[model samples]
Target chain A: MKIQLALDRLTIEQAVAVTRPVSPYIDWIEVGTSLIKEFGMDSVRALRNAYPDHVIVADMKTFDNAVYEFEMCFSAGADIATVMGAAPLVTIEACMNTAAKAGKKVMIDLLHTSEEQLEALQMYSDAIFCLHVSKDQQEMQGSTQGTEGFYVPPSLSGEGRKLAFAGGITVDMAQALTRIYPHVMIIGSAITKAKDPAAAAKTFYQLKKE
Target chain B: MKIQLALDRLTIEQAVAVTRPVSPYIDWIEVGTSLIKEFGMDSVRALRNAYPDHVIVADMKTFDNAVYEFEMCFSAGADIATVMGAAPLVTIEACMNTAAKAGKKVMIDLLHTSEEQLEALQMYSDAIFCLHVSKDQQEMQGSTQGTEGFYVPPSLSGEGRKLAFAGGITVDMAQALTRIYPHVMIIGSAITKAKDPAAAAKTFYQLKKE
Candidate 1:
């Protein structure tokens, strides 16, 4: 399992400062939804420029103009851009094609996607399917399995999609996911809000190394 | 009926310049989602500063920390801010409080919300419930009401909520919406993308005036 540190709430300057120390140990640096909206595509380029070799994931939470939105973000230099799973399948397919053509990746956020909708999308572009529990839901269940524990745990077959989870991921929670899922684990407040973000990230990467 | 001009895909300079000409006739000036994200709470501040007398709206697209988001936009001098209808009921209620306290307004973008969820938000905030069809849908609802409508005209009732509509809104489409519903009509690309944006805005305002 790989660890993706979600940098949120911090100002871009603060995010950059914190990222420097954590980047060596972390595999993915998520330019959060708030950051994307707060700074726009320039921040994606800034992060990409800042860390040329690292994976820069822009959490766009994109809804409409999937092609334009995805193209803009990826062109702005995001290694991966996200499309909402709740977005129309056509939109999802559009983003998938955009990502494929760009040689980048797209993650679908199933924040409130219905199972029937998920089942229907089983054949769409093989993008990473993220099971995100809404941030408002408060204090997610760590033992539930997968990333957010909102969806069924790792069967790891069917769609050839890589799995990622978000929403309130803690250090121990990330560790548990590392042991079981073979999926990418995303941490937001757990690292970004930590008193020592580097040390906290070290704790998660340390779990992966184990 | 009111005409709202959405200033999307422009630098703050372009947005301010565009609004300066159109604000005289327009009821509302929307600093669109793209501008809001590209620039931040500052986007609200800049547009609000430029058009002190006009109803400056910040498309914050509040999804989480609703009160915080609403307050941020309001403090930046927004007379109204948008919240996604897909957001939790609590999130919408939080925005209502912020709007009431700020003496401002909230517009709920019912981009993909179902009838059941819309029914649920009957009380608390008499927000401008927008029937938003995303630009990326690519489904092609042609030029007017009779030209293959993607959605039926929005039904506005229950606690007397106001209605607004958006998604590829043109002068003809704006005229159609004005004729069909005595509600706030949000026209984005129609005015913003016009060869003569101010004239395009004037035409929509003319429809509203009728």
Candidate 2:
């Protein structure tokens, strides 16, 4: 499993300084929704310049204007961009097509998507499906310990289909979650807020090996 | 009913210059979602600076981190900010409470919202409920001509509750849409992409009075 460090609520300079220490342990970097809204595509550009080798995920949480948003993210040097699964089916397809054209990737965020919506999305096998619990939901309902109600949709369970899990993940939950075999584990405050962020990320990275 | 000029896909300077001609016809100035994402809070601040007296609606289309997003919009000098109706109830409430505390307003974008979600949101009587069909949807399904299948829930039909209708609004539709009596009519490409945007806006504004 790969570890993605989510950068949010911080300025570009702070994000750059903070990530440098933990760079070796993280395989991907997520330029979170708030960070994008707060700083625009410049934030993405800054991170791309800072970490030239790491995969950057622009967490746009895009609900509409999928084609434009995905194009902007890719132009800003993001390797992958996210669109909400709750968006219109055409919107999701727009992202997929745009990503395919650019040789990039799209992650579908199933934040509030219904079962019916999930069923419709199963055909886009190449898109990464993120089983995300909202930050607000996490605050209200507490941590999910990575796999409380984990159920992979059959179509998405095929080989080469990528699955990502997010929302209040802790280092302690890393080992058990690996059993479910997620392609990416998105960790935010657990590492970003840690006093020893590099060590925290290293610990999670090491756990994946165990 | 009021006319809102939706400014999108333009630089901040271009947005300012474009609205100057139609300022009298438009009651509200919307810094659209793509504009906000492309330019960040600076877009809102620029419009606010240029049109100090005009009601500026920053269409954040906020789906999560509700409090932070609302706070950012309001602080950037937007008189009204939008949140997605499809967001969690707690997220909607956060927007409401933040708006209430700041003496500002929140518009709930009911784009692709489920009936159950709409039912739950009826309690926010003061919030402006926008019946929006996205640009992608309009392209895929054709123009709705203002009110093709308009249905107002009993709860939202109460006095003083504001409703805003958008999506492919044309000058011809204005006369018919006035009968439905939406609080605000959000017109985008119909005006922004018109040969004479000011004349187009004036035509819609004139129809409202007739």
Candidate 3:
């Protein structure tokens, strides 16, 4: 279970600064969707340059034009790029092809997908299937309120899914996920929004025994 | 029936120049998802400046945090920002709230969603629910090949599902969608990738007129 440090809401400079201390502790660094939207492809390039040895994931959560998006991020130096699993199978295939061509990995995000769609896309043996809780909108109304993070045992334990979980994961959730999921889990606000990000990340790493 | 022009795969300079001329003919200028990802929030700012009088829809197909993204795009000078229907219902609500606070509108992209999810989310009446076709994957795939450029109804079109269609529309498809669907239908590469884009756009308009 390699740790993936996701930099959400940090500027390119800040992302670099934050990762310099945490890079060795992290197996991968994610240029979050917010950063991508804020700074564009430059965000990918900068992070890749800063951490040449570390895997860089551009969280594009791409919905359409999958080939173009995957190519753009991969060219800019993303070791991994994400496409929404909720996208058509064609889109998912395009993403896989682009990643294959570039010798990169594709992380399929299962943000709001059905079980049928999940079963339909089970052929992606090489892809990392992520279960994400939307930090921007989780608990705004009735959709799982006041929870530090999501605990999806059914989805997390896929038959062969190379699982990756992301959201507002606290220390307790980190330990729980690490113990049971047997997959790479991601935490955003629990680390990035922390008063002491490095410490929070260190604690998460220690708890996960990574 | 309004004409929406998607400025995709063009440089920002080319986008501005193209948007200026096409603005009169088109009702909405889609700062397409491609432009937003390639150039970032600046895409919205530049497009909004280029066509001050026209409605600028920044294709920020957000799947995660809606508040931060909605605020960023709306502040960057977008009249509308997109949230993926594949996002959680809370995400949709957060986006709607942010839009309301910003005095803007939300276009919920129904990309690769099931009928149940669409039926589940029909409560966001203000959102212009889109029957979007993947700009890259859907067009080239054998299933939808040679069927580009038009609006086809979703498997289920329930109440409050205000429709907008896109996937490689054709002259015939555009003519048919404008006549059949009682909503905004998006026509992308079918018209833009044509040898003569303005003329192609004129064809969609001509069809709507007839």
In model 3, what is the error at residue A38, expressed in angstroms?
Answer: 1.6
Model 1: TM-score, first chain: 0.89
In DockQ terms, which candidate is top? 2
Model 3 misplaced stretches (Cα beyond 4 Å): A137-161, A208-210, B142-161
DockQ of each: 0.45, 0.69, 0.66
Error of 1 at A84 (Å): 1.3
> Any runs in candidate 2 off by more than 4 Å, and if so which?
A143-159, B143-149, B153-155
The list of candidate 1 runs beyond 4 A from truth reads A139-150, A153-159, B138-155
Two-chain DockQ for model 2: 0.69
Candidate 2 per-residue lDDT over residues B1-210, each given as its tens digit: 889999888889999999998999989999988888777888999999999989999999988888889898899999999999988888898899989999999999998888888889998988999988797787766646454446676767788889998878887666678888889999998898999988998899887787
Tens-digit lDDT track for model 1 on B1-210? 877888877788988887777777788889887776666666778888888888887887776656656766777788988887777666777788879888888888887776666677655446888877676653533323232343543445443557777777766666566655645777776666778877877787777667
Candidate 3 residue lDDT tens string, A16-111 = 887776665678889998898988899999999888998889999887788888888888899999988888788888899989988999998887
Report residue A56 deviation for candidate 3 (angstroms): 0.4
Candidates ranked by lDDT: 2, 3, 1
Interface RMSD per candidate (angstroms):
3.2, 1.2, 1.6
Please give the lDDT score at residue A149 for candidate 3: 38
lDDT of 1 by residue, A102-158 (tens): 999988877766665678666654678776765555532222333433445334355
